[model samples]
Target: MARPSQLSPIAEFARRHDPDRFLCALFAPPERRDALFALIAYNHELARAREAAKTPLIALMRLQWWRDAVAQAAEGLPARRHEVAAPLHAAIAAGALDPADLLALADAREVEAEEEGMPTREAFAAYLRGTAGGFAVAAGRLLGAAPALLPALQRAGAAYGLAGVLRSVRSLAGQGRCLLPQDALDATGLTPAAVVQAPEAARPVLAALAGESLATLDETRTTLRPLGRLAVAAALPAVLARRDLRRLSRGKTVSLDPRSLGDRLAVTLAGFTGRI
Candidate 1:
């Protein structure tokens, strides 16, 4: 592992707050590593709005701050002072990041800021598209990946993102949160209260979602066959995402937390072999 002393501030922030993504970012070329980390770190801050805000209004205000910062950065103006802001602006100024995609990701977080959870299955998928999918698009651009390589990256992001959500069904249930589509919950005859009280019963629903995520990931693999190593690295986190989905499909109640050596080894192998 790289020492904190060696990693840039944004890189360290990324590793601490979003380790799985940090691992994937580490594969970018040395010169681009910091920019990738900046992107990840910025995304981390966007997610933080949920925990830090006192209410939905506060959360939306927090997200608006990021949108404002991005607008400033896009125009080469000074952005609001924040740990991640300068580096994020630097990434954008270098042409490695896109303001539009960053704002889109922030826009997605508005759903999270709302008191109501995702209204429907379609809305939930669209949320993931705007959040994780948008992040992958930014990372791919930063890595100098071909525009043609983006759809695969977005699919990889959605698969990995959904797998992570499904893996946390129990824990999120305990908190009265459900990442599943509202319709899916209704279809399963599971209510938010029911899930919180008996997370075990939510397994079938979570397993079905995991299977869907796994299928999405498998489809992405075919797209990977033609990508160069840099582009492959951009979506490499999908390897662990696949492992997680398989675990859920088998009814294994694994924690959503990273598996340290196992995760590193799996992605390292995929990175070396370019096999997805």
Candidate 2:
């Protein structure tokens, strides 16, 4: 049997930043770990590509390549001939997943590729459901979660993903991109450009959205709790992290200072200790 390839540098960076994702993928079935990594690598690379593109058309074209690759992989041609193909190939062979899920993932990328700011709650939720939820559901299938568990897992994943997007406001704004839709800001009588220029003022709105997302995660956590040891082992840290971020946002601090790193790490550790 062939081993999956190593992650590209960019993908490796993404893994480091998203330790929660790395840990979750690690706890997944050994047979599926490589594929999950490959998926993460692809997502990270594609996001970089989209961010760096000079034009939405160019980014969209590149995303099409990944979308087609997923389709071909489902049909056994294994698009791009890279590592993500390994577990995906196996999952397809086992009839554990559908190509549509991968397509949905690609479609979500397509939305991001356009470089349009998220402007409304509906649009933001749609993006989350399609992009973040899509990846989680596909990865969960590979991890051997029954189809019945997918909905709850997806809800949890979307909440987690939303938290990430909110946390990334500072980072993304530096890159000349913003994911918080313009419409939502407009409704608040704030221009999308203004929010991009001054995200601090948007803290209350962002915090409220983050709270809603965490609530969804709470529901997801409750559903998974009865499922036993596997559920707790896989999701507790992320749940704790989300909850911590939610609580931290209540302060609506003016700055996400470096000093906060200790607090974030503490939440992660406490969650790991089951004191969460």
Candidate 1, residues 77-184: lDDT per residue as tens digits? 976688899999888888888899899889988887766787687888888777887888888877877888888888888777777777777777766666677777
lDDT of 2 by residue, 1-276 (tens): 122256544335435545456554544455555556555655565656577778888888877877777677677774455545555555555565567776778778777765556757898888887766777777666555666767876776677667667776777777667888676666567765666788676676677776666666666666765434333323444454465457646844433333255555654454344332
What's the lDDT for residue 249 in model 2?
Answer: 61
Q: Whose lDDT is greatest here? A: 1
- Quote the lDDT for 67 in model 1: 92
Best by TM-score: 1
Off by over 4 Å in 1: 1-4
Error of 1 at 175 (Å): 3.6
Error of 1 at 63 (Å): 0.5
TM-score of 2: 0.78
| Model 1, residue pairs in steric clash | none
